[model samples]
Target: MLKIGIIGYGTIGEDVVQAIGKDREGGIQVTSILVRDRSKYVVPSSLADLMTEQEAVFFANDFDIVVESAGHGAVKLYGEKVLAHGADLIVVSVGAFADEALQKRLMQKATERCRKIIIPSAAIGGLDRIAAGSLGPMEEVTLITRKPPKAWYGTLIEQQVSLTELTEPYCAFDGVARDSARLFPESVNVSAALSLAGIGFDRTKVKVFVDPHITSNTHEIEARGKFGQIMLQIQNTPSARNPKTGYIVAMSVMKTLRDRASHFVIGV
Candidate 1:
């Protein structure tokens, strides 16, 4: 089995564990779950035994990969440590890579250790195309993220705009992907992913909207390059436990894990 350690017990982490539990053929197992404080969370009965607060126990040599489903802070805390521990790292909070120094350090550690630092296509698709088109001259890439006003409740956008009182669509952020990722680490991860796959963070444009008219989180991607222009959009249902993120984000992580263990992989 592909033994994996997961950081965080929040929405994405729980969904990944539950999905892996239900998958009989995935050949994946959750060896450990690292949480900030075990006492703070009333973990489910099935996951109770796997939860641990000790960094040493969680970074034990038994795991083949460590998945970081926690926020950007957790990435900065455990990213290099996971690579140093000799396990491949899977990062769900891709926005953390916006920090150039941290990104370089973690990448260097993974390279020196000969381990992979994987980024799952969470909340969006067409990354493969972007990565491919990037080989040639690329003109531009832009990401427009529109989410329900409720999704912006605790985010920085609430300070810039009255999210609760927004009767129409309001553009809260319009800037480069780097600043967008750093500003809204929790919600603007897709912009970072797009920038990584297509262009550099400073070159990629990001626009965020808090729309009272939209019930679901929506993303629109536009890219132009030697491969030609392409436009893609997806409307994702928000996670029941966390409306700030999409439900498909967890499914994408699960798929990434399964692909690693499967003998026959359909999508790359």
Candidate 2:
């Protein structure tokens, strides 16, 4: 069985554990989890074998793969370390890679160690098409994200306008993926992932919308290139425990791990 280590024990982390536990295929199992505060969460005693130290989580854990559902800071802190230790690291926080310097350094470290960094299609779809479209000459790529106004409260958009009082759909910001990730770090991973897969960050455009009428987070991608134009949209419900993260993101991570551990993998 492939042993998996999770870097975050929040909503996404817990969800991954639950999904793996219920998976009848029995190909992969979550061997351990890393969290800053363990006492706050109730972990089952039956799965105590899966629990381990927090400080030495990365270096000490014995696992084949490390899944990072943690925030960008966690990715920046432990991403290279995980890959350097000869383990594949699956990063869910794709927005962190928007920093070209950091991305280059991580790739360099991974190359030196002969390990790989995997980016999952979290909270979005049609990545296969987007990646395929890259084979031809690409002209433009745009990602538009729409979410409830409440989701924008703590973000920088809060300063510009009241999220509660928005009567109409408002375009909070419009710029490149690099700027979007830098500006709204918590909400733009899909854009960053699309940018990396289709075009470079500078060339990929991003637009964030705050709609009072919308309940779920919506993502739309439109691309035009020599392969022609492709348009895709995803409407995602927030995770029940963590409203900030879409539930589909966790599902995508689980799907990636399952595919990696399975004998017959489908859809690269």
Could you estimate the TM-score for every candidate?
Answer: 0.98, 0.95
For model 1, how does the per-residue alpha-carbon lDDT over 161-229 read when each residue is reduced to its tens digit? 877788989988899999999999889999988999999899999999999998999999999999999
Residue ranges of candidate 1 with Cα displaced over 4 Å: none
Among all candidates shown, the one with the greatest TM-score: 1
Tens-digit lDDT string for candidate 2 (1-268): 8989888877887888888989998889777777776676777895555665464754676778899987899889989888877789999888999888899989999899888899899888878888899988999999999998867767889899987788999998899999898888778888888988898899999999998898899999999999889988889997666656788887899999998888887878
In angstroms, the error of model 1 at 117 is 0.6
Question: Scored by CA lDDT, what does every candidate get?
Answer: 0.91, 0.85
By TM-score, how accurate is candidate 1?
A: 0.98
What's the CA RMSD for each of the models? 1.0, 1.4
Candidate 1 global Cα RMSD: 1.0
Error of 1 at 209 (Å): 0.5
